[model samples]
Target: MNKSLIEKPAGCSSSILSRCRAAMLIGVSAILGSSSSDAAMNVGQNLDGITYYSSGSVFANSFKACGAWLTSPVAGGAWDTGFGDKGPSTDAAFVMRTDGYPTVVPFTAGGVSQYVHTLAPVYENGTHRLYFTGKGTVKYSGPGVAATTRVLTGGTVTFDVTVTGTNDLAAYNATGPSLRKGPSSWYIDILVSNSTDPVRDIRIMRPGYNTSGRDTFDSDFKTKLGFYHTFRVMDWLRTNNSPYTKFANTNGKDGTGIGKDFYSQGTGRGVSVDHICDLANETAKNIWICVPHAFTNAGMNDMAASFASKIGVGRKVHVEYSNEVWNGMFQQATWVAANVSGANTPQKYGTKAAEVFTAFKTKFDAAGKGSQLNRTLAGQAANSWILDNSLITAGSLTDSIAIAPYFGKVFTSLPSPLPTMDQLATDTYTIMPSVRSWLDSHKTLALSKGKVLLCYEGGQHYVGTGGSENNEALTDLLVDFNRDWRMKNLYRYTYMGDVNSRGVQLFTAFTLSSQWGKWGSWGSMEWLKQPIGPNSYEAGKEWGIRDWKTNNP
Candidate 1:
């Protein structure tokens, strides 16, 4: 008994019937074609002689069709953080039939699901293309009677940039650079020596009463601390011949340039964000810029979209959503990590931290916009044990990890009333094992998804206490350690910590000698000078003994 498959639609034209039979013989693999008004379709005839037609459309709704996914519930319906007006902000998706019938759908502004009815079919090159409209779509193969086995490999793919040449190494060891060994790394004694010219100044004197909480704007210090100084340091680095490991404002969850009162109020945490962009434009150089903030709420997507539009999509700018949401201290410090400092914040991390994370991922993966996201997750640890599995394992979400640990002594010259350097090294070493253990556990859980780890911001504290000898030893250890691991990216604590001399009891001798006198000095008074660590002058720019030897006292 030989086998002969047949397909017959009652009352159909002979030509249609003939085409149907041929299609059946070709099996379920669609040989879909379009002839202007007449669309040709292929159907597989089963043992019962019943045939099925491929019907559907492809649309650009879901971020190239890789938007939100249906997993658990949140708030009400499937937790949908909803992307900005521009669909999925990250990845892309498509479906295909072995017979050449194709349908492709992309995300629409971070939607949980796209509109289905409006999908369109694309016909070209003897092939008919189908795509999803709004809602997420699934691809199924085989005869319609009983579809068997789930096909899991039919989506876009991307790869990380492999570090090549000595460029990365050279940059890693540039002047005043920080170092890392395995998981533990910190800033060292590198110096940025400026010409004998006055360091820089912004003198504002108001004759009227100071309604903003102080009399003389001079005495009321603000510039002596925070990322403002960080910006200055970065600015100086750019002008100099240093390699650029860029920095930017990523805190956009709530509003613009890190909310209004970020340092105190939960507003504008990443105020210096604009500074990064401005710096890039002014220099016209392609440097690694990062937005330090969490994308917990929809705010990240909006900010990302805005920045992408300005910077042009798929450029060198890197935007990290939420700085460190995994840390236990998220409520108070979430903005610091996420970088969302704007007016009338869209949402907060009440019970929505995980939801925000999920939404952030969905948006990032929905559109091909992921190319614009060099998302990083930053965290602080007292020791190596701080980087356990729980910190990173979150599906295919995170891109990079920035570990900020004040491992060495509190200050380079003074000793803290705390633990010793040996203990510090021991604790720092423990972090690598903990990170490894955590990564191993999460790798198993996620099958090794997400970005490999990197330390973004970790430094030896130099504010209050810590033995000078310990600081020196730690510095040497960091140099040796960084050489060993060849850490990806490293940023020290900060540029200026001379704010301690503001009030009476707390004084510091460290002030940038200015033309009009120390800009940070008060009322023409030379305050009790407390020498900050070796690099405190220009924040490690001139700290290298090479420069010191050449310059002398």
Candidate 2:
């Protein structure tokens, strides 16, 4: 189900690769060419267009800014990810006991038992309740020194929270310890047991990052602005009979007909335009919303109308259908195959896409808002074949086409001895020419029909497929080897998107935040929960944010 960029079997291993060296390179799809360089810190051998160098600085040549794909918030004070919170004490999820010298022992602050640290911890879906019975006061403290203490009542108290970005815990910065401190960038809840007697103040709180000397590794906790999703257990959800939802608050029944939030009552499975607007409250900017093709016509209308009413007029609302429908990993792809007639055929996919778009557009038109010409982007597969039966089917309904300019395949179909990360980076570059040619031809085709091209998904896929190529050790080694130039090529692709200024209209990167993996660096924010510090691949996250900010379309 993982997007198969290469045709290698999932079970193929390095041993098999070694034995079939010559067979590996046969008939691979490539039409590489050398590209002229404009970067200031060039460091690679340009052989037929791909740069073989293993290291270099990110392109400072005025990066092409685009919108970051916001999917989930990643903020945890843990060392490992992918397992959620099952690691050692470095776990993002933690439990604190205020009895007898801190039995849980979450942190070691100058020999004193500190209870908080910066973490992109999980606050599962729902309310974090507090039950108070006996009389007792709870105190919250710690950052650098742990001096401040906020008090609250015991019996029963509630706090609403959601995942956002956590600020970096720099040992150099000051504002309290700064360690373990998760500002408004995070959503937390406090739960206590119900007691008959007046219970003391049991506060659920967080501390800043530890700046002192321990600023080297990940502190207990930290955070930034509100992101999308963060992995957390749902234990935070409380049953208080109040039944009031946090963000939407459209609990139980509402006279307004519309739910408090977008997905609260929508026919689709993901967030809606109003949901993005809700996010707008945190981001305070126009947003790009990817609507699922599965949405009912009614849901699409509500989403469209919601965008018009909430986002205000003239605000940019970049919209697209289900992401990568060509890839069967997602339900949309499978749904199309089983539902849409003839969509199973490669030639009929575009037709199915166009049909999907037209159906959504119909609802949008009924809403009497949103410029399909300027806003709606017809999503396409990342594959080279741009022309599809759907293009003709949509006809005038399609004005802009969206494609993912993703390249940099590492583990797919490599030569026998296996190339180094440097070679992988170089090989990725060789792919640009073919993509450029495709884009150029597509531009002519689009412009002929008064349409434009855009990149709905953009990032690096330079990872191995299954078998030994899927070995975690190899993955780590490559991550270390290509850390520098890998990013360079990533930015390189962004620049490629602007080929002759007729390339991509909006380059929406694959995501805004994620954990370690091929797609880890793809986010504007690293799955900050893992990795030691900024020295890790997460540095690319900053570069992503910078690039997005540069060309703020």
Candidate 3:
């Protein structure tokens, strides 16, 4: 839902409900429509399942234990350490520290002085060779450096490194590599013949890394069986802010262009479709893919065919046109608003979504896998009219209507001296009735149209907007609120409790793990390494959802 539509009233009691009602009314007035019948409420519907919305893939991201990168190094540039003024470096190279580094170094002389391109290999400890194709010199610095240098002669070159215990970046940086921790600044420099473009097809051939062709995912990632039911790859594919119109090549070179190497810079085009399919096949998890809005009919057909052929047997595919086309905050919404022709934004989105669904359905049906596809039409949870208009226009093409039924938007705009943790909890609990009412209306509409109800994203949405996020006091309050034990109760009891009883078939939590800051505390846990369990104070939203699944199952 658009943030501009929600208003923060002075009082906590009325503020939350009024904001929800205001958004609901705005949606109702946007389009004129009515449902003929309401589906009978299922009193105690067993939760179909609970899944996670994954955090995006980036060099600094710590969500996956095996790490997002295979062997490709972090791109060289001025490092944004979130403070200020980190020094410069050569292209395709990384610096360990600006204080100890030299500037204006030649590419032939190892790019930058005292700089070693860092990589996060698998957690397993042993001798492993980091492989890459091209003529280059591999040099290692910091701890775990077994063989310092290996010369490359336009062929695969392997550098050996021995890791001890679990690779924790904080410990590695603080006290070197230990049995329980690894350094974040473990550096390996690869100076290739081509200065502009470094090495190609870099592979970290470690024990838990992609050493075997069968199991490519990290050991820690694969061990989390609860999160494997479905993996939404919106962030993995870099769907937002993407400009891809065609499929990424599986064998393309790194740094050439968009959609090339799977390990290209995080800001570049997304990973290949082959990698996404491989992840699903290896993990045996259903994949929810968001088609890029810029894709043409041919591109859509190609993507569908690729998934139909490559996706493992019996694993389902949840297909959404794009991530929130109705929310004007994203580029896709803006693109549709300008490019797509319709009576309104919902109709235009519906028209394009129908076309996308048709393309995927045709290919999947042709491949004899139509039953494995879940065609989802997403809309704002607060707005029934968006779904009403879109679903009506989409007709039989959509199999499910998806929405994000999050609570706590009232806190986003609340002024300084924000509500206390107890007050926020009260407001959260008070708003449950309204959220349930909204769900009841949408569930009925979905059933009336013969479509299932699914949640693409949902959880505590207590982030500030405009310049409110910059308020240090507000940021501190929100962070503390997330860490508080009461927040867990609200998630397990009020939020998930409501959705489960309301008969939402699938409720995917907003995200897996992320660092909490001014932007938003979207992650269930602060990071993958954070302690998680019923007794652990560090456990927050992740524990709540996990505990719910255990009891419900």
Best by TM-score, which number? 3
Candidate 2 lDDT by residue in tens digits, 1-553: 0111211221222210011110011011222221322321111000000011101101110000001111111233433222211112222223222110112222333333233221112211222222222333333222222233323444444332222333332111243211122222121111121233323222222222111111111122222322222111001111001112122212212111233221112111222234335434433434545444444455445544555566544444555554445554445556656655653433354555454456545645665644622444343433334344446555566667655444455454434666665565455444444545555566666676677665554444444554444455555555454355444433433333243144444445444333233212333333333332235434453453343333332
TM-score for each candidate, following the candidate numbering: 0.30, 0.52, 0.72
Question: lDDT of each prediction vs. the true structure?
Answer: 0.24, 0.34, 0.54
lDDT of 1 by residue, 1-553 (tens): 1111111111111110011100001001011110111211110000000011101001111111111122211223533233221112212321211111112223233344331111111111111112211212233111111222221222321111111121111122333324211111110110111222211110111112212221112221222221111112111111111111122224222233332212111112222233334433433422233333333344544544444444433434433333333443333343433543322122222222334345444554565555654443333332222233333332234554433322222222443444443343333332343433432332233223444443233222212212332354444443333222111111111111101111111111111211011000110111111121233222232122112212221
RMSD of 3: 9.7
Give the TM-score ranking, best first: 3, 2, 1
Off by over 4 Å in 1: 1-254, 257-275, 281-296, 325-330, 333-369, 380-393, 410-450, 462-553
Better of 1 and 2 by lDDT: 2
What would the C-alpha RMSD of candidate 2 be, to one decimal place? 14.7
Error of 3 at 424 (Å): 1.5
Model 2 is weakest, by summed lDDT over 10 consecutive residues, at: 45-54
- Identify the leading candidate in terms of lDDT: 3
